[model samples]
Target chain A: SQQGEEDPQALSIQEGENATMNCSYKTSINNLQWYRQNSGRGLVHLILIRSNEREKHSGRLRVTLDTSKKSSSLLITASRAADTASYFCATAGGGGSNYKLTFGKGTLLTVNP
Target chain B: IAGITQAPTSQILAAGRRMTLRCTQDMRHNAMYWYRQDLGLGLRLIHYSNTAGTTGKGEVPDGYSVSRANTDDFPLTLASAVPSQTSVYFCASTAAGPNTGELFFGEGSRLTVL
Candidate 1:
């Protein structure tokens, strides 16, 4: 079973529009991180929000974590074609020496010019 | 920084053959990980090492094996390749600390099993 799941398997939008993706996890986590992957490439870290933090921002990227709802959302403001990629949400489970991250299926965002 | 690098950007192997995917990081991070990405399945952890010389199983470790002989290299091996094992493999590393958990990933290795 997958620990995290993202909604809207695929999304398409025009440039300058805001793109939002949501992720839901099954268990408590110490932190949640968002990553972006271009076609045929490995993932790149975008932002991370700890369990205690409600929201975070980096450049045009914004992330929100709601532990109560076991969900998080990533928002890209004024999206560009370069932002077209797969967005994944990973959760770092609480406790244990694992420190392993569980990832969601991901949201494929396609930004068109 | 060069970051992480994976060998053999792409490969095609027969089903009963053995193959090893190499991953090396230059950042000297304390933690390393191997993950497989399949279409629609996203990325699943295959193995992880908190530090050099120690390894642990992850969500999907059934057909894969990993070894961390040193801090810079972590390689994943498949004893008998299967069609289901064909996917893109990624290697990632992170620093050692509570506040240091962001992973830096390699370009990824794409494997095709015939």
Candidate 2:
């Protein structure tokens, strides 16, 4: 079963615009992470936010985690054509030695030049 | 040059044939994983290894088997391929601890079972 589900299957925007993607999960998590994947390529980690953290930023990327709602969001500011890729949200569940990570379906973002 | 690598970028095999997907990591990470990505199902974990000499089943382990012989290699084997098993397979790894749960992935291997 999928623990996380991203909203907005697809999103299209022009350059210089901001892109926001949301993800919701079913169970409690220790941390939430966001990743980016280009066509026919491997996935790259973008950022991560722990359950105790509400928000974190890395360059133009910002990630927010709302443990109360079991949801998280990724914000990409000043999007560019290079930012066109599929974004995925992953939730890390379990504790001690049984830690596991579950990923969502993902949201496809297109930044048109 | 310092990340996970997978063999057979893509392959097509007839049903009932046996196939193995190879995954090797150069980072010397202790944890490795195998996942299958379908059209609408996202990426489902097939198997994982916390460290060398230990393996665990994930959400979807049917039709797939994995082995972790050493810290650098984790291979997934399909006893008998089925059309339903057609999907892109990915290999990933993390450091000694999975506290942050950040993964580095290989390009992926597209497999088609006819």
Candidate 3:
């Protein structure tokens, strides 16, 4: 079973604009992480926000987690063409063991240059 | 580079044929995982090993088998391929356990069963 679900299945935006994607999970998590995958490539770790952290940032990426609501949001400020990729949200913990990372249907973000 | 490596970047096999996907990590991580990604279905865990000599089933392990004989290698095998098993398979590992750290992923193995 999938633990996380990303909203806005697909999004398109101008290169300079900001893109935001949201995710909601079914169970309590130890930490929520986001990964990016380019076409025909592997998924790369982007950022992680623990249950205790409300928000965190790395370069142009910003991630926010709300344990109470069981939701999280990823914001990419000043998006670029290189940032065009599928973004996935994964949750660790809650569904039996903390060793498994359950990923959601990703959000496809397309940045038009 | 210090990361996970997967074999046969892509492959196509006839239905009912046996196939195996190889995964190796150099980081010496204690936990390793196999996940299959399908269109619109997202990524589903196929199998995982928290440490060498121990393996566990994930959400979707019905058609797959995985073995972790050592710390650096984990291989997934399909006794008889099926059309439903066609998907992109990824191998990943985490140094401290998935819950505590980020995962390092391999490029992925694309498999097609016809």
Q: What TM-scores does chain A show, candidate by candidate in order? A: 0.96, 0.97, 0.95
After TM-score superposition, the amount by which residue A82's alpha carbon in candidate 3 deviates from its true location, in angstroms, is: 0.5
C-alpha TM-scores of all predictions: 0.97, 0.98, 0.97
Worst 10 residues of 3 chain B by lDDT: B95-104
Off by over 4 Å in 1: A94-96
The TM-score that candidate 2 achieves is 0.98
Tens-digit lDDT track for model 2 on B21-93? 9999998888888999988888999999888999999999999999998999999999999999999999999
lDDT string for model 1 (B2-114, tens) is 99999989999999999999999999998999999998888999999989999999889998999999999999999999999999999999884763388889999999999
**What is the C-alpha local distance difference test score of each model?**
0.91, 0.91, 0.93
Residue A99 CA displacement from its true place in model 1, Å? 0.9
Predicted complexes: DockQ each: 0.58, 0.68, 0.61
DockQ of candidate 2 relative to the true structure: 0.68
Mind giving the per-residue lDDT tens digits that candidate 2 earns over A80-104? 9999999999988865456667899
* Model 2: residues with Cα > 4 Å off, grouped in runs: B96-98
Backbone clash numbers for all candidates listed: 0, 0, 0
State the lDDT of candidate 3 residue by residue for A1-113, as single tens digits. Answer: 89999999999999999999999998889999999999999999999888899999999999999898999999999999999999999998843234778999999999999
Model 2 score (lDDT): 0.91
Please give the C-alpha DockQ score of model 1.
0.58
